[model samples]
Target chain A: MSDPGTITDSGSSGEAPVTMLATPIRLDYQYTAGLSQSRFLQGIAQGKFIGQRCPACHKVYVPPRGSCPTDGVATTDPVELSNSGTVTTYCVVNVPFQGQSIEIPYICAQILLDGANIAFMGLIQELPATDVRMGMRVEAVWLPKDQWGLTMASVKYFRPNGEPDADYETFKEYL
Target chain B: MADSEVLRAPHVLEYPYVRSVGPVIGAFLTGLRDGRILGAQSRDAQGKATVIVPPTEYDPVTSADVGALVEVGQSGVVTTWSWAPEPKKDQPLDRPFAWVLVRLDGATTAMLHVVDAGSLDAMSSGMRVTARWRPAAERVGRVQDIECFVPEAANP
Candidate 1:
């Protein structure tokens, strides 16, 4: 074929021209969760919470970021933490947003898994958004084993574990 | 742990944006839609009217807004460019082309576009090129309205 980039006076200009275009972009990434988080993600696929313990402060971190933020030391020891934890703090989302799959008025909270120093953000469900409060105990609701992968998607969401509300003083400093 | 022992997952990030191209750019694209090339009339630090193609909202040097759209030539000089040996998806051309900054006649600033010179041997700085537009019917008010620029000497 000849050069495609050519001004050929062929087709008739009949219809009114388009003035606006809505551009949607999708970017694909092959995210390699490094050794520490890789072990954490791989562990979650098997229904386990693999955390790392800081050698200096002895504080365990869930989904370790390779080093201790406080001590500035490497976290070497892998500690298996409880799937259940206390909600350190939380916020009730009422405003809708793009790519929002969950229904409105849901509770998103910082969950401090037992024996882990750092709290991770998680969705707290199976209870009213207003009812989710500080120091509330919650447990992971794991998806089917066959659907598990090297991702946090293994745990669907957190629900009240039927335990009494934890004392606020125990988790207030971590907030 | 060994590198292969680590597991991986495919991660996708999507951003959907609907933004209005304001008057300055709207005029330029509208010109493209009607088979004309227009540049924005802005002033430089010296206060002389500088015409910029694919116009900017603010004066690039002074960052002041507001400009009258002025017509620029379809033919331009390639100021500088890099060769795209293997063009990726969504590029102006599928075949080998050079991503160029072409300074059109009657315009002070250069607009980035591509030059289809057939091969690297045909591409060079200061090479004269002309816009090879799409047929009138296919002219959308988008940058792709000008399909790609070709070397002026050969095409002429």
Candidate 2:
């Protein structure tokens, strides 16, 4: 091989004809889950909700990450979170896609689990899609223990928790 | 907690891509599919003829248009190598193998490929090796068409 640093200034002599061929490639990859995420997933499997507290900001994160996005510091404190929380926002999904497990017109909501600073998205069920709204309290509906594993899928979805809508002032920061 | 353990599970991601191999590379790949190895003919700044295996369209040193297509021998010498004690997914072989740079008989540059020598003890720089091509029926215009290289002495 030629030294990569050397400049090759010789212009093409332009002597030969050109042709193109089609080539297709397929690749597969496996990614290992990191520490914080793995612990969160394990907690879900055991019917427990866990969050990490950023030592600097004191903000709690459910589905904990290694570092605090805001302060750029490690979140070392693990806090158990309540399953019921308020929906900070939501969207109605009407478009269909391949291999979709749910029907069209489902509600995907972002819930701020009680005691956690960050919110996570989950499917909303039981109530009419149009009735799902911000500030509405919802609780996780877990699958049977036998079906639990190292996956968030253990929580089938979140449904209305029968609590009155939380005041906007209570979850305004999460939105 | 200091004593806490992290959970893990297998996850697979896959994607399919299509690309066009232009004139120079197209010719090379087509040659592979047809059971032949082709090299690009080029000259250095001093006007010395050089044949680069797995041909590049232009001369690497002078950037001159490559001269012509040349057929090279299947046999080569391992210029250097590293051992893969446990094969990863999609590697040429499942057992231990050596990832080597081989300089084909008539080529001036080396190409990278795996050498399935069965044991690390048999692999070394300067050892003679030959392309162990897949059966004609299974030949695709891709690099894997040559399943891997094997020690020349072990060739049947």
Highest DockQ among the candidates is held by which one? Answer: 1
- Alpha-carbon runs more than 4 Å astray in model 1: A1-29, B39-73, B86-89, B103-110
Chain B TM-score, one value per candidate, order as shown: 0.87, 0.91
Model 2 lDDT per residue over B73-154, tens place: 9999999999999999767898999999999999999999999999989989999999999987787677888999999989
Provide the global lDDT of candidate 2 against the true structure: 0.83
Give the TM-score comparing model 1 with the true structure, all chains together.
0.80
Please give the DockQ score of every candidate, comma-separated.
0.26, 0.22
Q: Model 1, retained fraction of real contacts?
A: 0.51
Worst 10 residues of 1 chain A by lDDT: A1-10
Q: What fraction of native interface contacts is shared by candidate 2?
A: 0.37
Task: Give per-residue lDDT, candidate 1, residue A170.
Answer: 86
What tens-digit string does per-residue lDDT give for candidate 2 at A82-143?
98999999999999986699987999999999999989999999988989989999999999
List the pairs of residues colliding in candidate 2. none
